[model samples]
Target: MAAPETRWLAVNGAKCRVRTKGTGRPIGFLAGLDGALTWTPFLERLAGERQVIVASLPGFAGSNGHDRLDQHLDWLLATEELLRGAGLAGADLIGSSVGGALAADVAAVWPGLVRKLALIAPFGLYDEGEPTFDVFAVRPGTLQNHVCANPENFAQATAQPAGEDAMEWQVTQLRTNEAAARLLWPLGDTRLALRLPRLTTETLLVWGADDRVVPPSYAGRFQKLIKGKTTIATIAGAGHLAELDAPDAVAAAILEFLG
Candidate 1:
């Protein structure tokens, strides 16, 4: 696969990093707490038919500070600005984990901005019976265990170099976690249920059967909230990061939905 071209854009007075691949109708992808680095395989698959734009959230990867975005609504506005700045205002949108929640909010608030929506284990709702794991509290080595069902994918995603490189990676992860916590800590709910009804685009909700971070049951909740055309799929033997745990399945589902 060809390497994705990375570029920087100024969105809402913050520098945002965007990786573009292939060329065709635009598909904007929002990365999760771990960023878009691990989704290269998934993006590569989608790029074959459409232009794929992966944007890192503020404070992750090459993006600027996240502190300016104090609330989930701010993040939604920033995302809107980013997509418009990148000429993807009406692109098909896909997001995972926290990114999913952001994508949903953007689609709801600005229904025309997203032509179609796909969310995988998105974090935006809280279920009392199936509480989300407190990822911020988990110890370093143990956190990976809750991320994905496949051990091989988990290992590859969390692998790090030794010495200074390891330290830098740790810092980057910490910052990313901090940014995610701003929207998902304590309770992962952003009251997205209220806004979900406003989404007019066709929506796809994918969940991992073994997702511990956001619980698989939330998939039903999402289905109930979305007022538009919706479909749900569960990837067996997968966890929170369904795209990483079952990349081909997730990619196929996304392409099928977009088509």
Candidate 2:
């Protein structure tokens, strides 16, 4: 496949890097914790069938301005602008982890913009009875184990570039973590349950049966709260970052839903 065309655009006052590849009906993808520094095999597979647009959120992948968003409303508005700026209006949307929560918010508040939604281990709900894993507490050396079903997936995802690029890569990871922590620290819930009932878009919740970050059990809660058509697809032997652990399976599930 050809390399994704890349560009920089201003989103909610932050400079964001946007990458686009393939050619067909467009699909917008909001990345999770890592900020989509590079497109993975899973995204490449999706691109084979349709246009895939991935954007690096503020403070991730060298993008800046995450500190500007201090409240949930700030995030919501920023996400909406990203979709519109990327020419993803009315397109099928996919979000993972924190991105999933934002996508759910957009689907609820601006249903007309997202034709369909898919969330992979999305963060937005906190069930004390079934406490989610504390990502912030995990040491840097062990973060991979907590987020990936296969620790090697995490290693690959976080592979340090060689030579001069390595230092920049490390700084980028730190920025990404800080950005994610700003939204997910303490508990990841943003009172999303109250707004989920307002979401009318068809939704698919994809969970990794082995997810430790947001436990697969949380899928049930999402299904219950989303008022529109919603279903769950559990990928066995996958964890929080299932797309990295089981790219083909994740891609297949998303493609089926998009179809």
Candidate 3:
């Protein structure tokens, strides 16, 4: 039971901060679009089971970068370098939301870098002709309404006890949701969605059964598309962020799938 280590490293000159905890076969946990790793219970569960390395994507958390540094594809390269820096060659990868697309893209391009894959309610999967909700037009009440559908998990996430400023911070997460959208051409436009079928690693797709953001129907699409020995597991009463909805359930599902 080693203590978690926090350190910084640079990939292609982009500075990335990695939080590593526990010990065993290395596994990387990626954050979604809004970029925050506040899921202590979930991360602790994984850290206790394996050597966990949570990589902060550049410009999202504490990571910093400069102009001309394209983040989407660059993040894949950065991930490979980060794994190597941690003395890891191949690892189990789990990604949520925006992170899922990153994970899938990485698995497709560097097929040997990943041992298995888990995508939790990933974004960037919409078809070219499909319509998407504009993040900008999403009212706070609407966001909270959709998110709070899973009351138990939503409470766990917002945990906005009396004066914790949790609601304000959530507003921040909701507001900045467009940063990733601005970076990527559009969900599924980069061709990774089309290339999902090309991945050779065993894959696990987890979607919130009641997801409003990226409808559960997309889970069927992922099941039908990815070429790997992929398995899709749906978490009930969860919205887009299944981790926040039911971290324990999501973590358990991941443990079963990855193990």
Candidate 4:
């Protein structure tokens, strides 16, 4: 496979890093709390059939200009600019976790921007009876247990690089988490339910059956709230980051839905 082309774009006055690979109709992807600084196998698989364009959220994954967003409105506006600036308008879209919430928001506020939407364990709804797990409370070494079906995946992804790159990599990880906290702090819910009724795009809700960070049952709540044609897919043995645990399964589900 060839390397993805990288570019920096200005969106809502902030600088964002964007990447594109493959060819054909476009598929815009927004990654979870841990942004996609580089193309992963799961993304590469998606690129096999269509053009995959991934963008790092402002202030995350080495992107700049996050400071420009001071509130939810700022985020929403920035997201709109990001989509338009990155040429993702009117494209098939996919998002996971934090990115999922943003994608849904964009679809809701700007119904015609995304033709189809797929969300992977998106975090935006909260149920008091079945509380979402506190990802921040987990101990450093054991945090993966709650997010990954197999902890080794996190271990490998976070493995400190050798030599001069090690410190930079570690700092990026910490800052990424900090940036996520800005949006998901206290509780992950950002009242997305209130906006769901406005969503008109065809949607797919994909969840990891073994997810602990955001329980798989939340799929029902999301489905009920969305006004559009919505479907659900469960990947057995996967956790919060289903694509990381079962890339082929996630990719298959998304590809089928896109078709």
Query: Candidate 2: which pairs clash?
Result: none
lDDT of 3 by residue, 26-121 (tens): 888777644643445667788878988877665555465523346556656765676666554588988887778777777877778789989987
Report how far residue 106 has shifted in candidate 4, in Å.
0.9
lDDT of 4 by residue, 1-259 (tens): 6889988998777678889999999999988865775567789999999999997887777677666777888888888888888899999999999899989998999979999999999988899999888887878768778788998766655566455387788777776677677777778988899999999899999999999999999999999999999999999999998888888999999999999
**Per-model C-alpha lDDT, please?**
0.83, 0.87, 0.69, 0.86
TM-score of each: 0.93, 0.96, 0.81, 0.95
Give the per-residue lDDT of model 2 (tens digit) for 181-254. 88777799888998999999999999999999898989999999998999899999899988889989998999
True-structure Cα RMSD, model 1: 2.0
Query: Per-residue lDDT tens digits of candidate 1, residues 67-173?
Result: 89987778888888888887788889999998999899989999799999999999988888778887778876676677888666766755663443767777777
Which regions of candidate 4 deviate over 4 angstroms? 158-164
| Candidate 1, poorest ten consecutive residues by summed lDDT | 155-164
- Provide the clash count, candidate 3: 1
Candidate 4 residue-wise lDDT at 26: 94
